[model samples]
Target: FGTDTANQVEEALKSFKQANVQTLVLDLRDNGGGYLTAATDILDLFFSSDEVIYQMKEKNSAAKKYYASTDSKYEFVNGYILVNGNTASASELTAGALQSEKGYQLVGTTTYGKGSAQTQKTLSDGSVLKYTYAKWMIPNGTCINGKGLTPDIEVENVSLDGISTKDVKETLKVDCVNTRIKSMQKMLNILGYSADREDGYFSVATQDALKKFEADNDLTVDGEYSQNDKQMMIARMMIYINNHENDKQYEYLMKIIK
Candidate 1:
């Protein structure tokens, strides 16, 4: 969220209205969150001016509710928010408000619980110190601190093993046991090659899968993982994700929407 995020969303809604689009899917996955005003501004686009968007509680103070300040610009018969583990703070705030206020269902994994708000102060030496001063809650008054909001429709994307080519520092071959091998194994599985196992062990089946990947991509058909192989595998992984061939979350969303 930023100063321009609400403006950008408003512009996009205008396009959607012109195209006669009634259903909406707001994807907030991996959004670490930003300006609280931006979140409220975007929420105003969908909520009535009198509705409560969220609530905040300061130390030793009563909870204060924030109401929508603007009339809705668009109203859809159905809407869904996509969230994941990285959806935190203001993003979580937006998702939780939409879920609680509008009855909009959330689709995907649990959010990154971040209910606390912080303020910064500059010291005499000009250094800045940030500290939590308040906690924010959803419209229904649930403070999602360490316990994140669970989705109404839970779905997960295909695993990427959370490793990349940069993480592979050494060549990997048969009988070697490492996280890099597990990453390569997962990638191979997603790319339609069977690596047999994904336990960080470079078994014979894993070597065969690597060789097949190399042969298919016109690289040298060696049963070993090298720097070039790592690069090529990463490229193929990107292509797979870009093509949305393994987007299980999206697939489930479409199934329910249809």
Candidate 2:
């Protein structure tokens, strides 16, 4: 949290510099946050010395300003900070600092706004007392306490549209043979409805599975995977994969559909 963490970050930056990486993307979609100093220290890497990165103001204590140090080691041409609803506290600090100070672009959805600073105090008992000590602000004096910072490029949590199977006919019944039938089977299995296999043949097992899926999802249970059923499955699979966005299997399913 103190020295070792800073050392690791420095080492990673060294590697990036050695590789001559110009564009850096820091993906902090699910990063919750940690030591406040660590956030500011990393923020220091992008800007020159004496630049105001962030501000800390408490009720009782005087306002404190955090400035960038002489640690502009990597002169990256551009920086992108990826964030979402799970990005909070230190993650927000880092994003806000870079955006406000260096004009770095933020991608993805809005962040989880938690701009309060906390301090740890040791009591007589051996236990520590942690309390909110200050509130942080961006360099422009913008407070991101309850309202999260919006991304410059707002990409919805779902994948882009038109990522489904192509050239679907109006009807697909049992024993129907189509090349995309295998893709349908793959998506069905991914959504937990067993298509049994992906042999590009619409067998009876696939039909039964489709019927059960349609019934469960409140679609027309006609035992036929028609155009309406394909549309319904597309919507259903989008929602399912959105919910399971972090799972690699669902991610692969998304890629295959595209």
Candidate 3:
């Protein structure tokens, strides 16, 4: 979902060496684990004497923890990582290593709680199970198998206004979100929303169309559309569409698209 690993890590360290950095936050919300060897090499940058960072055990096989010979080069003034229930596998491994082992503080919510390790193997049935065959444990010997590590600090936008979709004038990332406006227009046309175009460009007519869509869905009458506002509105339409077309072969696929 981002730049290549080598580039991202190098850029991070370069940014780190820039100034007196306090409270660095590494976000791994939608990150999926890649090459184990790559993960091992990256972990070496954060540890002393290239010791074992993590042990990946799978199936009835012998388990092994990776070790690096190189010493740690950069230490954080304040290291913080963000993980959500979406975080999985090697992401959890890195977080657990830095936290329970290397002592990097964790923020945000708990992890996905998927502790069992899986290696790719073709099954006898010619299908892939990606089965979990072994458990991964942190250096502190805490096995986060099935139960994720809870965040030290839980930040909730507890304001009722936070949940309220009404009165939002605009989104923060407006330029990057105009493509969504096009999608809204397409969906609006499918549902009889009036608009002159579906070109994926934001225009006054598109904003008005969104306002009408919001009003139809009982969303706040705000003229400017936020990502959530659009998403919630789409989700409602999709649910209605699904309910009516539940018998369609593509109905489940529609849900997946959503």
- C-alpha RMSD of each candidate structure in angstroms: 1.7, 12.0, 14.8
Query: If the candidates were sorted by their lDDT against the true structure, best first, what order would they fall in?
Result: 1, 2, 3
TM-score of 3: 0.55
Top candidate, metric lDDT: 1
Tell me the tens digit of each residue's lDDT in model 3 across 16-73.
7797665556766546655545555666777777466777666687666656658755
Clashing residue pairs found in predicted model 1? none
Model 1 spans > 4 angstroms off: none
**TM-scores of the candidates in the order shown:** 0.93, 0.61, 0.55
Candidate 3: Cα lDDT at 195 = 58
Candidate 3, residue 191: Cα displacement in angstroms equals 22
Candidate 1, position 104, lDDT:
85
* Candidate 1: 10-residue stretch with minimal lDDT: 159-168
